[model samples]
Target: MQRRSFASAVSAAAAAPFLMGAAPSGGDTPASAAADKRLKRDMVASLEAELQDRDTARAVAAWIYDIGFDWTPATAPIGAFDFLIAYAFGNRPPANGGDPTKVLAEPGPMNELLADTVAQVRAKRTLPVYAQWEIAHFLTEKYNMSQVIAINPVIAADGTITYLSTDGVAAQIAEKRKSTPGGVGTAGVVGWRDHIKRCVLTTEGRGMKAFAPEGFTMPDTYDPESGQPWTRRRDLYLVHDMNAQWQMKRTELVARMYPNG
Candidate 1:
């Protein structure tokens, strides 16, 4: 499948958004760069392409049966930017290793996304949602959803906390499935449209078939403080799109190298 390249869609350099003149981050203040009509058209077109695959539809159907048969959980991996922003901006880490409980104390875009995921679960027969790091903490603590496969963060010998990346989370889910009797090998991945394709690919790399439904995209609202939209910050959106492309390609290469996994 020849997916549209975000690079081709947006003429701006992938790093353009972070430069000095870059548009303000967050809130309703529109970035001059993001206002490029051509970029918006191409981006929307490319993002829409992410859902044209038949696998997504199949995944939705599979979820119905798997939920009834064995309660296969859908994975809700957090986006990297969400954590980086909070961490970079004086969100103090808990003593010693980073504590998921103490991280992301206040609600943000990720919380809104998880809320949508939780709603999907409730609407779709109450299956578990597999989550990691701050996302899992919110799932179990804020929403009080017990049907969750929460992947804990890895604490290093130096007490440094390293949360699992998307691939790492997929590996954990795969490993968990291996030990459980009759664990369903198929999973649904809940994520933004731009990032969901990569999420599905990483899950597949871990030896399980995965699918991501369409329309669960980033919120369009602006932050009152920064006036930048969650994913609309021209730089942030381009960076994510480019990164998703790279990660998807890397996942394909890795899968080829380790076919047996």
Candidate 2:
């Protein structure tokens, strides 16, 4: 699809209200549930078509909008952080000849990765990139990337970071676009592969012309005993995919149930 048509589709999807029907409740009939399921499926299909469109993927945007992931105090950084680093550095080969598993197993490799990422961002990026949640804060401090704008994360008095919902992040981006002078209305939504479709939907739902290119996949580790890869990351991918489905359905349901609100 052409960029103009894509933008129109996004706007129409964002502005379109839910098909009116009996809302689901505790005493809802099977028919109502079936209707709900069909509605959700149709919405998913529409969003997926946009995501899978080659022209949509190739469409250039003024800003790269990275959706954040979990960042605990103990873990410090998560898979999405690695994705952000890789994107900033243009996914260049690691000094260890592009082996991600080695980068994971080797000591001090992550530090080196950070240093290289910082250098790349500083050299290549002319403007501050927008990243949601605590990843933005962590990237700024650790990579010395003063060029990252963090959106909608709460930092407590004790320094604990509380991240907001994906919808919240999308809404904030929409508001920012409206406020900025001569701001480009399009953005490239970035996140895990399983999560990117939902992110793009939420972004478009907020009236931003957004498309998700191929998302970054986290490297999986092998099982020590079976020598099988993706032992743990398999579960992670499944959980993320399921959660993405639920979140997308819930957003539509909420909008339908509270049409006036």
Candidate 3:
């Protein structure tokens, strides 16, 4: 959220991101930060407060899907969001105009496009995680520091979806920690953690093509199924193992770290 290239090198000013989460830093690194300790503490506390309200949780869900749902015109949270999710995934032009750039620029036309986008997301994909990543790909780069969300979905073995939030202490450790000397972005956190838990380790290493465009070739064992990128590690985890232990770790970590702090 602080425009620190947590996902991709998404420009903060313009914010055209590839994705919001990291692609596994090849090792287990802590989720520490360089910001003032007091500020981080306050921000975490504020997020906790926000989650207590029903309205806030709804808004957060919409935001997690915003990239595909498109930023503005978030009134129709479910249906509207679903449409944009489709439009974004389709990578098709809006009905208002042939060019998405032009239509997106003008809110009048963009709103119309958004309405249509929601339908597309619904028609094509049932899961909205794809759309969420798309938005994170861009928004996470330049969004204001206060505008961050943790929409990581952890599916339990029993077919339960537990969306991980930034409100958790362990999840916070997955941020772009900068305290380590000579290892600013090299050491990975969230993406890597998901990969380890979700995807089966190959003879080579973590597979991450789904998270990248076709051109950015990774490793040999990184081959993902069609439309299945490493970004969807949560889903992979579900397919491989159906457990909520990871989510439990985050929950426990929160109590230990903020014990009446």
Candidate 4:
């Protein structure tokens, strides 16, 4: 079965399915770009502040992870991290030399930043595939095989896969886990088995359903390319990891959320 993967899964998205190409010319005015030095200062301070707390750090890490998946290493997370590190130590005297790894690995940052980054991702949730790429890309002379933290892949409903990680600035993210039903987000598992909450797509691939959840039933879903609407149909057994494909169920779905029986 296939499901949605993203930076976040909370709160329903916009009223209209993302208008795609362009708006009707009546949108809020866009802000001017920040100066490089100002951007650097803000980013460094944001990193430092975010790293102070475990939850925020994890969120930062998740951002890096999704960024990688969205753009691969063509968009490195480390440049920002290095910038933050340099800022932290630049004010200090030469004798108190700053090493990026040493500062990041210390107690104040470490796991604290990693975990916080996770929360930020969930809170700022949006369509993962719809994220920005040019804004994230950073040209580098050397390609480091690994950043500070490498993350698991978040597979899309269309067999698209994404891997996330950290840049090692003030951001550090602990490994995240979906430990409970409430933590399931859009994962195949829903509420309880006896009072199960589930989602399904029509065999004809033009309709959908999300049982028992408020605002989820017959949601305002649509195809990105054809811009067509889906028709409702009887529920299908949703077995296997739904992240693979929205309509692609690999195994016979069971009443239970676990064990794949």
Candidate 5:
């Protein structure tokens, strides 16, 4: 029900890419940053080159839809919903899953749809609560990834309610941090990190199974406060759109791999 602030969103976007390995660390020199940007541009161009053929688009779309549910956006920007649909169906798969080449195609209907949804949200002044519900609906209906919906609780017009899973609560907490100023280092972030460490990293939350994919396993150790161990649970925790930093990294990678056009 609460709306996220613009500043918090920007911070999340900036931090996410670094956490996901999409960008060079803040310590990089200006030349290195420029080179990285150039590489991303080239990657985008290459993908567009391949997508000149319509047949490629359809093929890429099908493959992306199939695997995207399990794909973590933290690993790449290809999970930007619309971009994923265009790239996998348009371009051939890269040797590595993180290849930007697969996502260089022009925007497709999926992109349009996402754009429209965002527009509507903005036009109607939709709050974060609404966005959360929309995300839950999208994940459940489109991908059959029930886990997404399971983690998000919903309140009905009639005052009835649907409960979200523990992981869902964790996600909400993460979203909150992304929407709040200095959230990544705030008490909320620390609390969420501790929750994951205790729940996903320790045996207590494991047996409860409130937030993981069915049959998902947790890692033996983690750096929850720092985003490490790269476990399945950690990936799930990091799977938030509010993390703009991650998104920027993904965009940069896409641009680097397909620059020129």
Candidate 6:
């Protein structure tokens, strides 16, 4: 069957919140181009150096996954594919979420698949390339998802695992979310809350060392069981309590940056 384009799906999903009267007006602050350029340079340099050592490359990829999966806030659709594209390509905004001229231009379709894929991977942490290809096809042919599955795999040493493929990971996450008890909507919300509190907020306040690396110093203000600085945890709870209100306003901003399927 024919595959759907990314832009179409995004456009459709982007309209959902607005149609529901849940989305607000306004766009997210796009990341600074200069900062993005610098980050790209640093990341390329880091990846280049690490790739020379096979073990190091694997470790780095694993680290990327840990930080990525850990820190991503569970608020609304997080646009994991968009985030990866922005990070990988650097300094270039896609014509419509991804490069239109190159391929994967259909924003609405691609993002719908992306949203579904993220939900899947967040649950199972694994997937196959063919499955994702099928998903891309299904999205295009069946659901008008997106036609972008242009990424190459970052294979493991034993060759039994594939660590990086935006579409593949997404399919895994989407499948997991489907089987989840509360369903995609509730799981996404709850996951985002947990991620925000456990990952983003904590990392922002302290750093990555808190959870990984045995010698990592614990913040004097942190409680072992609670996983946050005492002062910050209290503040986060208050903030989290207000998240529903905040998200209602923020969804529009995120949608503007992401658009939808």
Clashing residue pairs in candidate 1 (N, C-alpha, C atoms within 3 angstroms): 26-226, 26-227, 26-228, 27-223, 27-227, 27-228, 28-227
| Candidate 1 structure quality by residue, lDDT tens digits, 1-261 | 234344233323322332223343333256534553334344434544766643333332232222222211233433210110101001123435445543432334544565556455445445556666456566666677766666666876766656556677777777777875565455656654444555666677788767643323433332343212334454565465455555565565468546898
lDDT (10s digit) by residue, model 2, range 41-144? 45445554778642232221100111122110111112212122111111223346444433322212222333343335445434445665334544666667
- Candidate 4: deviation at residue 216, Å? 26
Ranking by lDDT: 1, 2, 6, 5, 3, 4
Give candidate 2 misplaced runs (Cα > 4 Å): 1-127, 155-161, 213-233, 250-261
Candidate number that wins on TM-score, 1 or 5:
1
lDDT for each candidate structure: 0.47, 0.44, 0.28, 0.22, 0.32, 0.32
- Ten-residue region with minimum lDDT total, candidate 4: 82-91
State residue 166's C-alpha deviation in candidate 3, in Å. 21
Q: Is candidate 3 or candidate 6 better by TM-score?
A: 6
Residue-by-residue lDDT tens digits, candidate 6, 1-261: 123345435444543332233222122223443343344345435765866643333334333333332232423233221111100110112344542333332222322333354334433322222123323443345544332333333444654423233224334444444554544322211112222234322222221111211111112221223312221344454344344334533554466656872
Deviation in Å, model 6, residue 36 alpha carbon: 3.5
Q: Residue 32 in model 2: shift from native, Å?
A: 35
Q: What TM-score should be assigned to candidate 6?
A: 0.22
* Cα distance off (Å), candidate 2, residue 79: 26
**Which candidate, 1 or 3, has the higher lDDT?**
1
User: Which tens-of-lDDT digit does each residue in 1-261 have in candidate 3?
Assistant: 543343223222212221222232333243422222333334434644876643333333332332222211101123222111111111223346543323321212222232233233334433222222323333334332122232334556765544333223222322322333433221111122222222211101221111111111112122222122322334553333223334433454467547785
- In the range 96-158, model 5's lDDT, one tens digit per residue, is 435232222232222233323333322333222212332434434554332222223466675
Runs in model 1 deviating more than 4 A are 1-107, 214-234, 247-261
Q: Which stretches of candidate 6 lie over 4 Å from their true place?
A: 1-28, 31-34, 50-70, 77-185, 188-194, 197-261
How big is the positional error of residue 35 in model 5, measured in Å on the Cα after superposition? 2.4
For candidate 4, give the lDDT.
0.22
Model 4 residue 4 CA deviation (Å) reads: 33
